[model samples]
Target: MNAHPDTPPASLPLFLHDSVADAVALSAVDSLAPLLGIAVKEAEKVVLKANECAAGFTVREILCTNETREILRELVKLLASYAVTKTGMATCMTRTPTLDPDALRKRFDDVREGMRLHELLDGEQIAAVQELFAKAEIAPIRFDTTPVIATRRRGLESKLQERYGDYVRVAVVDSAATAQALLREAYPVLLVADADEIVLDEPGIISIPEHAVADDSIVYPEFVVQSFRAKSAAIAAFVQLVTEFDERKTSSLLDKISIPDLEAVLALLAELARDESAHKVNLADTVLSWEEAINQEARFIAQTGGGADDFKAYLDEAVISMADELQLAGEDRDLLLESAYENLERGPPFEFSRAHTIRLQEHYARRIAEQRYFRLRDYATRLIPYEEAVNTALKRLFYLDFLFAVARFSHEFGLTIPEISSDGLGVIKGRNLFLVDEELKGGETVVPISYSVGSTDLGIFGATPLPVAILTGANSGGKTCLLITLATSMILTELGLPVPAERAEIPLLPLYLYRRKMIKKTGSFEYSMRALSRIFMREGPKVVLIDELEALTEPGAMGRIMAALLNHLPASTRAVMITHLIHELRPHIDLKKIRVDGIESEGLDATGNFIVDRQPLFNHIGSSTPELVITKLMSRVRKAKLRAVYREILQALEKERDAWP
Candidate 1:
């Protein structure tokens, strides 16, 4: 049950306190699951749970990051050697039946009762009378001598014939010499006679002892009871093993994982390997083959109406097919065919024998039953002792699959464990993972941007970083992408997962919220205000990312609202607000409390794309640079008058740019 024994300790932070944070965290996981080669639902459940437990992590837990890394490394190495598939792991999951000890004991008792000789007696009396003897003297009949002794002997023979007639032959011989002759012929014979008259030294001959005859308490051999118990337990355990153990291969990068959890998985894997190597018996295959044979016979009977002729033909085909399936030949094939024919001749389903077809069906049923009882008995004898261990190991194998998936994700993405910061958040060379592939497809690499908020020093920002900042930039200057990158890094690090950054120092904040830019619509402004107001009300060390709040109202009023909101935010919060109304808002905000950062466009390149620096500049404001965009359009225009009009507008924009900042 303690599958995650080495999970993060109490000092680690979680970001799922509110629905917003959960949305952000889940979105991050959903985007990461495919990259990690795991199912989305599985990743969400495991990653979120781990993050929740990681809150309030102790110093020891923080130090264990290295151990987590080492475990992931080991998993990666193992996966490199073994190309395990989900289908293969599914095959390893065997279904074992629940073998209740009491039920098994009852079954054994029932079989034992059936094997008892007293069950056949039912208070019958033997009346012995004078009878002719061969090579023996008929002395004074001492034991219930009467003429009815022959009749009593015939009744006993009938009962024995009813019980084991198919598997054995019962003969009532007048003398021991006749029993010895039958034994010499190698016939399986159970001899029934008066104790005084029955005496044989043959190995194969079965006879009741004098004591058993006097007590009327003979029973089947002890091995039968023992075999029955073994088979019951083994079949149940085997069925469970087949059905439940569904661990898949793990070979990718994962978030932070506990060392104890990893070691536990390794131990279970070792135990399973050892058990498999030691037994060397293919019990599953044997069981399946017998089941297939029975199923094929049943279908044939159902289709052919179970005629004697049809059964003989089916048996002929079954022998060859079953022999190939079981890889048996010669005597083994002959023995199987002989057993089937013998069961057919045994007559009647013991419970329902009115129909000939029903009796034929019972033959196939009994043959398969016999096969399972013997084979499972042998397997169960060896497996019973390790039942508990095997079950536990299988359950642990499932945990192993989760770990492997996480490891493989981490490995493939080249994610590194981020340091847990007590103060601000900082990422050195952070790239937005969500855009990495798309950017690459466009023949351009993702520009890794480094930025910091709060007091964390990244050596690029010269001055001390403020806890609150207003982000401004030209259109398509990567301001929104930067916010997303920072948010992604924070959420991932908080969840104990590696981030898409070269180096990151993330605060262990219990709350994280990222609100994407909302388009201006009726009631949307009210909704946005309500959502943003909750951020100020919350009291904790947290991180908040908001984009384009100015779109909600007029520039002047929105600027005042932005200043008031930023000023009212708790000092414990680190926040970044992306907006184009900085010029209208800067007059109302306290310069000492808030910093301004910008992503500036450096005009157009030869391809007519904006040459922009994606990294934000600390303590600077950026222009929207509409004039440069207009200038690019002017070059593509053919009308002389339109071009002249653009030139005049550009001249006016130049004057405004020069006077604005």
Candidate 2:
């Protein structure tokens, strides 16, 4: 199909990605030329394993990063160009099951007499196979994935028995490397796209329709995907690590607190890698202060024990004495006294400890009983006036630390963090990149974060030298902003001015993408587990962009899987995963939220069309330079009905494209 209309003009300079080894990735495309051509040479019978994510008679909509399909198509086309003889192709990625005899036959005859679909397995009787393989599960899952396993088994066995009768030793290509030998060469090159659309619905076998207009096609956006606590914990850990690292590497002031070596600190940081239950210890002073306070209270409670529950009265007396001795004011002393009571009763709290201890059990219990009492009379405990001095300075204490610095900067510049209640929702933009194809160059597919009133600093992740970004949005709201002038800001950033903001931290990364293929959210895997696992290993400043992670699998399973992956990743990694399955991803990635440019309540209109009201082309799009035609068109469209009508014409043209072949 022709490129989407709103895709950036092909002539733009940012369209290309330059790696350290080469100036442009043109050779990267050429690299596949040979592989595709090779498939044409020796393997006339190709049993390809395509990961199809569609209903019947559908093709993948995303481009560039849907490498598995793209590479296979290239391989098939290249082989055809090579003039291979009697070529037969079979794929495992299909909307329907091969066991569905009628559907299988229909799929087989679709383009060629032997062309099969993306998912299939040929074997013994369909009834027997179905009974033997099916596991039985709920929605978004194929409980009986046995057909797939069986189909491959049967297909290969038939080939083995038929041998030459089956044609040129079938060339096989699948994500399952173990079965590679079942095909021709046994060693097939892998071609993959690093970014694509995140699935939207469960059992994402149903493909989402393209944007209503060619220019305003809806893609998803990346919101913070991690659960609140999970994300906070990760960010806390990251902040701790980075700040500590800076103290060591840059400040050297940490020399006073730094241990001679990790050996001097803990015997085996490496050994913990293999062990599951190892207790982790933190640096000195970080929690020691909190612990020491608890310990003092614990010792007093233990001493007062002996079924002499009335001894608890001594705790109050002791507190009174200490408060008077320290010359503390009532409020100041009350907090300490209250903290001490809780430590004696509850043993520990989320405020200071991740878990609790048994040795101090009774102390903690009594502390809980007298907890409110202390808080009630906190005014009376004239203890040292110290708490105020400690917490007086900062207000950004989510991690128990203040960030007046960030606040001051925002206030000074009159920048406001977008409030969820604000009229204008949020913004999503891409500066510049190579003028790829429609699904790519245009801002159709974006992984946007659910952001409130402010901009975030991000490291750049695209082909080296040139910047290319893929954003996925919610079903409707994200379509327009995906590209248009959003790309302009990216261009300005490349030109070396701050990208319309005060700070930006852009890093380089190896992009991995996946488009359509009903990705079932399994408890065992996050969306694109195989894809992420394959590429997540690359070290240093890499961007892991996923459009629809939750749409990849069942809803229940999607959350668990995404959580697992997020738990496994270090906080340093940068990633963007966009999907309509917001709840599923919010547990992992940070949100860059945006609201509908206009009314957002009506989901799909009566005609199965997206009903988001379009905003004027972003006047504030930073400095790169937006296409004049792009800006002009964005402002003119006012009616959803009109836009939908226009989209119909585009679809007609798209359908006509198929008539060409």
Candidate 3:
């Protein structure tokens, strides 16, 4: 196959090279799979392979770059389509069992032996005979000797003799005498029948009489007559069997069996008859030996300048001497003579102008080229171990396709590869990466929150990086989103992929996301806490994400319980905990060991919407009071009693106004 002129060929590196040192699992991949638009099984494989840090990072960078990404995208789609086409072709691949070369040679030898009576003929005549024999289905004879068949054969012979011959004869002449008689004929001898003719009405046989010619020499006619004496002899031997079997009824009965079974049975019978039968012409053998045909054609091409007109003309004339030497007599010799003459008069034409000859040469040249091409094609198919190669190619293609998918994902999420950090993770202006489909959120701008662990922003918390942080904020004020952003960024970076942030520093740690499992059965909270304890104790510098501390137990007790859990966890662990009960847990956690962050709602807007600042307030002490909730709810309280209760809530807010700051 030729390469497309427009395409610049490139060989892409394998996505997962064996040289990679580290391979880690990213827990976030389950959530991230849909973002990449891949199945879970595929996503898992890609993520695991990509976690082989070095190569993953290199491949990811290569694919994620703007120019390379676009090129790979088109390449992937093209390869995918080609792979599908190959798959379809494989499904449609069918083969007919082939004969061995030796078997094919034997078949040709047999055919030649059967047609040997015609050896006296020219090359053109011999070639024609060979071609006709190739077409004949000469399986062993199973003569259907029903009355109907016999009658039909008789009628056919009668019509052939009547139409072609002007005279008829029924002679029991010997071979030499028969030849002598033919030498005496003036008019052409059309057909001759011996014992076979007797069965199909011997009276209808056709022949011509002897006549005198010039110079006391005999001139033989082109036409000859033949008898089916061999076939007649076989029929006579099987006369009892032929009489007993009714062809019509047997055929109808065989048709009642399933087609496949009937065919199998008939094939077995044919094979049996071929082994037993003596009459060769009655055989129904239609199997074309490809090897025989190819070898024969090759030999012919090597002769006579591959069928030049002069060579054909010479063969047509030269074959007469061969005919005169043949010992075959009577009907057999006549039949061969008839076929030879027929072939000489009209067979494959060789005469042509120089230009036409050149054209023919070019055509055969192209054909030879194509024949070699197919031969190589078939040889390669048989010789090469393709299963392994196909699998390897498919893996490469899949990797390319996946890389493109990630490119598109990164483009949509506005992602970039983050600077790797050994200590822990850090991010600046990081968006909520889990909210992959922004439009689904009804046009709400995804709040980009900036916070860090194992590193601190200089402006707010100074340069000292903390390994643990407590995120406390107003309900629905985006603390969970912020925590998710940090964790997701780290996960993506760890996977050697891009993070959805302006700037990020990530640690290569096994990440664990600790969230309350919502089990319908009772005592699930205790079970979850115990699991959390076991997870927290695992060796770190690992990062852990905790959401909604209240889900662990009763809200009033959760603050103390969470505070205890945080304090007991390994100091080497980096943790982010999102909780609403910040004030309750504050006194229990050692300030020197953890950083405190919060999402603050400055106040409500004129429309009663809280003007919540989505940014993380680093190193801050802030509480989300019920004041805004009560204020927003005041309008919805319609009953007079509820209004009075709302007034009391307002009066209490007034009393606490001095301590609001």
Question: Best-fitting candidate, measured by lDDT?
Answer: 1
Q: Write the per-residue lDDT of candidate 3 for residues 373-417, one digit (tens) a residue.
A: 333233323322322322232222222223333444555667766
Cα displacement (angstroms), candidate 1, residue 606, comes to: 2.7
Give a tens-digit lDDT track for model 2, residues 105-186.
3332332211121012233332322232121110111111100111122345343223112112233324344333321222
Q: What is each predicted model's overall lDDT from 0 to 1?
A: 0.49, 0.28, 0.43
lDDT of 1 by residue, 156-230 (tens): 755543332322344555666765555444332334445666355443344444233221112222122222232
Report the alpha-carbon TM-score of model 2 versus the true structure. Answer: 0.22
| TM value for model 1 | 0.47
Which runs in model 3 stand beyond 4 Å of their true positions? Answer: 1-378, 381-400, 440-442, 456-464, 516-523, 623-625, 634-661
Q: State the TM-score for model 3.
A: 0.43
